[model samples]
Target: MSQKRLLLWVFHSFTLIAGIQFLQYYIFYNSSYPFPYTANLVNSFGTFYTYLLLLPLVFYSAKSAFSNLENRVQRMLLLVLSGLLVSMLHLFVMHFVNWLQIYQWTEDPFWNSYRFLISKWLHFELIAYFLFVLAWRFLVFEKKGSEASKPEYWTQIKVKEAGLVSFVPVEEIRWIEAYDNYIKVRTKKDKFHLVRMPLREIEAKLDSGHFKRIHRSTIVAIREVVAIHQDNGQYRVLLEDNSTLKLSRTFKKSIEDSIRV
Candidate 1:
């Protein structure tokens, strides 16, 4: 994530909890609940701050425990394990922070709270982990939907590798080159995939305005082209990845025109 986005997320989360705390105080006071305002807000915000700090732990736990298991049952088990592990770690941190903050880092109080927190909020901690994960997944789905709605000159590509199939967004592809019996697609990230199609056939399907054939064997995403240079006596097309491909004399003008526009 970009630093700007991360900061925005943190600000949003802080405001959300602050708003909730105020609402909770208002409701409790009106309903004759006897909890003191400072105590209530302090505890909730303390938890919120600790949760913010431990968010990385949650992500790391999920990723480390995932194991890439394809089996549905195993995947579910790993997910639950991740949830449990993060919950436990969160519970630990909450106690540690409470000890440092409220208990003044006293040895006895820290040990006492640490020992009994599990019995008190084990289910609540696990539920919080699940809620965070569920919310993250929902945001990711919404993001994908938003990206899908955007106007794109080219559609996705179906790629099969390692006995598994996946779709690569066409906008991510930087260039393509003809390989015997197939075309090699190179993404902006420098990952390559051999697509089972002739260069001429695939070229027809591409958006002419976005992709320009530089050579009989190479076609580049026009937007990714950084510059064109004639080094020595040969024409070359420079791409965003800092690599160059041979530019056929016949297609040089076509690429220049497409990229210019």
Candidate 2:
């Protein structure tokens, strides 16, 4: 993640924990409970601290499991295991905190108090873990949708030729050819423009779905392709303007995959 995004995630996580804890405190304060306000506040803060400490682990495990595991069944199994582990860790911490409180307030044995605490809170802890997993899945879904909706092409490009500089619509470009240290851009209107930039640099800016580099020195717009033919062990791309360009064997499969009949 970028630094800005990391900071945003941290800020949001902290805000969510603090908001939830405050709400818990308010509810407890207004209710007719036997517990003192200090106990309620301490318990709320403990819950907040447990989740805050587990956030990084939860995020990393979810990301790694989804990205590294290709099998759907395996990915799901890993996610479930991670959730259970986190929940168990939370339970342990909560028990430890409760043990400390009991030791300070009463003379009850640590094991007896810990067992009672686990029996009371285990079900709720599991519910929280499930929610955490669901939240991570939602975040992944949102990120994927955001990426899919982004624009895939440049609207226009600036070109200079013959002491004149002008902006050309990217859709009008038919093909590009590498010329020494510069590139030559050809348009559907039979206009030729020269720009003092490397072919690789221009290729990076072009949308992969709309244009493809067929050779080290040539990039063609997919919409301008008329036909692809193989002759004498050589591949050729026929363009809309009755022009044919050699297709490198290295890129033949990619071109074939990108174009549909």
Candidate 3:
């Protein structure tokens, strides 16, 4: 990760924990018989800062599990285990901090309040652990998707013809259609070639700016598209070559976004 991304990730982690802590503090402080304002603020934010100690553990474990575990069940098991370990470490740290800050103010020994603290915060701590995991997943996937959106599309498709292999400029191809197990790559001049490739695979290779899938088994060149006709909520795409193709209901929104009309 870059320095900028690292800082952004840290900011998100702190924001999540700080927001939760603020809400928790506000609720407790507004209740009847609340503790003194100074004590309440310090104790609440102290716990928030202590949570910072486990942020590294939470993010590192989540990242490791996502990278190493492909199975959903395995990932969940590893995350649960990591969450348990983080909670254990947090409990010890919180106990030590409590003792250090309140030894002069309270009579309760640190060891004596272990069970009380567990009862008060164990479930909530586990909840916070899961929240950190969710935050990591959201940030990581959004970054990956943002980068992948600007992919370099294929320029030329290899063509194997007769006993010799050739090349077809992607611009010359008018549309592609699925023909049984292979795809029929058709050109504007009415010539066609069959290739052992899936429609979806070829569609991914094409630039969305130049070609758009109008159906599950059909992709048309944007320049070849002349007009669209609609009737009874169904759509048909008319091409300049006098070929008309079904504009599937599922792909209607995709066409609208691509054509911007």
Candidate 4:
């Protein structure tokens, strides 16, 4: 991904988490407690705990939506199921801890009371599950909106008939070598087509997760980078195939930043 996009996704993730907390707090506080301001704050605390405890849910939901789930139904199902499971686990632990307190202190406040614990837990489970659904919807909407807003040039690829040829999958491409007006996409299997597209144009067509510009005429795939070695203060990516590609010092950090592992 471009540096700008990576930063945007990070910001979006935080915003979604905060938004969920606010909305869930509003719903729970209004329904379960009578106080306006104070109950709202308490609800916020609950949502905070929910966010902290359910961090995996947020990550998985994003991963499922972006990388795995192909349909909206599956995405929503995963989000809801994961959300409910995480919430129930938190609720059980909270109630169990409260039970330990009640045994030691001999207090009864319905807040932690066991009289209708099952029903109350179920209620909160529904609420937490709804929060996850809201998050899923938000991500889907954001993706659609982003797609709609992209410039036409980014999605439209120029067609040039290159007589019975095969191209590489965007994922398998490690780098592209640009010479004059033609760029060669290098993959694990072999060097593919020599297209007349500019490196920038081809980069736009490829998946950002797999390809990134490391120099004016070079782009590298993070997955294929086996090692980053320095030679006389210059950086180079040693690939899985034992091939080495030079990384320009100017864009070295940007390339390094995109490597997830």
Tens-place lDDT per residue, model 4, 42-144, is 3445434544555556555656665677898887777677666676666666565545534335556545464466566767666755655455446554566
The 10-residue segment of model 4 with minimum total lDDT is 152-161
Give lDDT per model, in order.
0.76, 0.78, 0.79, 0.64
Reference-based lDDT, residue 30, model 2: 39
lDDT per residue (tens digit) for residues 161-209 in model 1: 8899998888998999999999999998789998899999888878887
Predicted candidate 3 versus true structure: per-residue lDDT over 1-261, tens digit per residue: 432475466667666776677667677654652455445555656666777767778888888787678899999999999998888678877677656656436777666687788878888889989987877767674465467778888898887878788778898999999998789999967999888788889999999888999998999888888878996778999888888888998887877776674
Taking all chains together, the TM-score of candidate 4 against the true structure is: 0.41
Give the TM-scores of the predictions, in the order they appear: 0.44, 0.53, 0.53, 0.41
Model 3 per-residue lDDT at 146:
67
Candidate 2 is scored at a TM of 0.53
- Expressed as tens digits, the lDDT of each residue in 1-261 for candidate 2 is 342464367557766776687677768663775556666666766666777688677777777776688998998888788877787778778767765754556777777776776788777876766665566656564476478778666767898767788999989999999999989899989998888899988888889888999998999999998889998899999998999999999998888888873
lDDT of 2: 0.78
Clashing pairs in 4: none
Q: Which portions of model 2 show Cα errors greater than 4 Å?
A: 1-119, 122-127, 138-152, 162-164, 230-233
